[model samples]
Target chain A: MKPYELTISQAHERLKQKELSAVELTRSVLDRIHAVENRVNAYITIDEKLALDQAEIADGLIARDNMTPLTGIPLAIKDLICTKGLRTTCASRILENFVPPYDATVIEKLKSAGTVIVGKVNMDEFAMGSSTENSGIKITHNPWDLTRSPGGSSGGSAAAVSADMCLGALGSDTGGSIRQPASHCGIVGLKPTYGRVSRYGLVAFASSLDQIGPLTRDVRDCAVMMNVISGHDAKDSTSVPKSVPNYLDFLNGDLKNTVVGIPREYQSARGLDSDVADAVTNAIQTIESMGARCVEVSLPHTEYAVAAYYVIAPSEASSNLARYDGVKYGFRDRDKSDLLDMYRSSRSKGFGPEVQRRILLGTFSLSSGYYDAYYRKASQVRTRIMEDFKQAFEKCDVLLSPVAPTPAFPIGENADDPLTIYLSDIFTISANLAGIPGLSVPCGFSSGGLPIGLQIMGPHFSEGQLLKTAWHFEQAIGIQDRKPEIGS
Target chain B: MKITPEEVIHVANLARLDLDEAVVEKVSHQMGAILEYIDKLNEVDTSHVQPTTHAIFLTNAFRDDLVHEHLERNQALCNAPQRDETCFLVPRIIG
Candidate 1:
């Protein structure tokens, strides 16, 4: 296998054994990125020189025998994470030229762990859309079929890893940004429980829901990334002070005595494609075969997830994004003379249509006389949704469902209808609403050969259980060897 | 319509967006549809339920009142669209 195709654990083993150099691995991945980036459009920025420098440092660490599991691995970062000296555009023109003077907490941790930063990948502008089509920079195509979208708003991150542009990547999940794309691209992604990973420098998008996680080639690599990125930081108050477990310890490929809850709501969800449903059902049977006890459970408030998410996410976004006026940083409309005119003009021109729609929706919801009817009402429903998950978890260790209603869809399929796209997140949004950990592992493929992902969710801070369950499912699935025929 | 063009424009103004007539009309229609769907929230009675602003509840985070090294003035001003030596230059807020 090419160095770029090596998973994090494989690359780390090779590096530790002196069979491969960090520079060689980083160069191979960079060459793959240069070779396939045109067709994939997975990255917003490709920092060759900076990546090589970091890899050299990683090589030095490996030579000293002071390497972490990710020490010599080349990884891609979703563009929204603040990387000092690297242009961190949240895939929006507003921050197109903005460069942070300091690294995000995760970047600092990754750098300390001796990981090489390949570059920043694209996403939905402010992570507002389910497809990367909303990206102000460019759309990321699915590696499986270039005509279909690599799901978003972490589409670029998923496509990059799936196409072997990077061994693994860090993706931030707000609603379903990380897991959905990983599902569509046939990779493993984990969205840790809210506050499991510090969001210190993640550009705020619905602050309460946004979380950073990993998209990797398999379950073990996801655990490797979680070890490095998951922790509390003083910079973010929401970060939980709870101790983190070594995720690699959970990957024993054993499902004995595991109680898996199959939500009745997801089994009968509207618009769930037959291929996705069959894949999930088959995955459950595989889990059962491995000594897991599968039981039917109800998340009664599942139907309201999408509606509550739209109201709550946008309402928080409108408030969080209010800082993007023409003053401190990012794009500014300098042509306007009046201060108020500049604020309006800068924001109107700086933000894309989807972002503006969300802002407008948020503003409308939070507006006087509408607060009680919209924002407050959504919050109450959110409470019920959390309660539903809490009750379901009482009977089961982890819940199983299809990551998305279907596999990757053709680009521009739901572009014009925002509501249609919003409905697509029905399965994954509840995890974020309840602040629980969720993982997406490749289960099966659609008739067209697109990937389907099985989602496993657990209560807050139960990432260890979620990772273990996914690892067992992945080991038994026998499809981990499949690769998209991109840049080969 | 769940939302009118007038309300769309009003919300846009409140959000500090300078939307044109076309955008206002389009957003009005779109928001109307989205709001109609969101009205589904009313189907569930939450009369006695408390609103959850955050998924995981935690108390306010506090630290010792000691200053640590932070971004320099230049570092903070580096990404500004317009800046002088120290402060971000903006359109005059007052005469």
Candidate 2:
């Protein structure tokens, strides 16, 4: 296998033995990126010199027998996370030239562990869209088929990992951003429980729903990355003061007493592709044959998730994104005569149409007359959705469903249709809504040969259990060993 | 509620976005359709349920009062589109 194709665990083993230096591994990944980046368009920035410099330092740590699992691993960061000198654009032109003065907490953690920072990946502008076509910077194409979207707003993260541009990438999940893309790109994407990972510098979309997690080629790599990024931080009040488990240790490979619940609402939802349904149904059967019990459960409020999410996410977005006015650090209209005009013109020109649409939707939802009708109603419905998950967990260990209603769709298929795109996140958004851990693992491919993903969701902080179950199922299916023909 | 072109422009102004009249018309139709679909929530009664702003229960998270190192003045201003040596430069606000 190519060095760039190595999982974090595999790379760690080779580096520890001195069989592969961090520089060689980083170079192989960068070479792979340099080879297909034009076609894949995964990264917004690739700082080769800085990446190699970090790899050299990682090599120094490895030689002294002092290292973390991620020590020599080259990982791509979603542009949302702040890196001291790197341009963290969040794939929006408003912040296109903006660079942070300090590292986000996760970046600080990764740097301290001696990992190589490859570059920033593309995302939907401000993480407001399901497809990366909403990216103000670049459109990240799926590795499986260049004509298709990789999924977003974590599209670049997923695309980079699938193409072996990087070993693993960090992605933020707000309404299936991470998992959906991972599904599309044929890799593993894990969205930890809300508050499980600190949202300190994760540029807020819906402050209540967003959580940062990893996208990797396999489940164990997900676990390895999870161990490094999950922890409590003082900077984020929402960071749960809870115990951080050694997630890798959960990969014991036994699903002996596990109960996987299949949500009926999801199984019978509108627009669910028959191929995706069959693949997920097969995944449940595979786990059952492996000694786990499969039971049908219902999350009655599932139909209302997208409706609630659209209102809640954007309303919060309107407030959180309020910081991007002309005055601060991002784009500013120098020609405007006054402050308000400057604010209006700068934002109008800096943001794309989808972003503008969302901001308007948000502003309307949160306006005084409509707040009770839209925003407050959405929040109340959100509570009921959380309650439904809580009730279902009483019957099962984890919920098994399709990550998306369908496999990766053609680019621009729903670009102009906001409602269709919003409905695409039906299955995965509930996990984000309820603040539960969710994972998207490659199950089977569509008749069109596009990869379909099985979404495994668990109760709050059940990441360890979720990863373990996905690991067992992955081992049985052995799909992670398969690679896209584009790079392979 | 039926969203109007005038409403779209109003919301855009509230959002600090100066949009074209055509874009506002497009958005008005789009947002109107979205709001009509989201009207699905009105079918469910949530009068008794408390609104949840966050998934997990958390309250004020305080930090130590001790002084800690922060970014230098120059580093803080590095990404500013228009900044003087001392601060960010914006259009006249107090005139």
Every model's TM-score: 0.99, 0.99
lDDT of 1 by residue, A33-131 (tens): 889999999999989999999999999998999999989789999999999999999999899998999999999999999999999999999998888
Candidate 1 interface RMSD to the true structure: 0.7
Q: How many residue pairs clash in model 2?
A: 0
Among the numbered candidates, top DockQ falls to 1
The lDDT of model 1 is: 0.93
lDDT against the true structure, per candidate, is 0.93, 0.91
> In model 1 chain A, which range of ten residues has the least summed lDDT?
A479-488
Give the Cα error of residue A363 in candidate 1, in Å.
0.5
Error of 2 at A235 (Å): 0.7
Error of 2 at A461 (Å): 0.5
The digit string of per-residue lDDT tens for model 2 on A1-488 reads 88998888999999999999999999999899889999999999999999999999999999999999999899999999889888899899999888888888999999999999999999999888888999999888998999999999899999999998999999999999999999998899999999988887778888988999999989999999999899999989889999999998999969999999989898789999999989988988999999999899999999999999999998888888889986768888889979888888899889888888888888999998999999999999999999999999999999999999888989989867898899888988888888999999999999999998989999999999999999999999996445888944
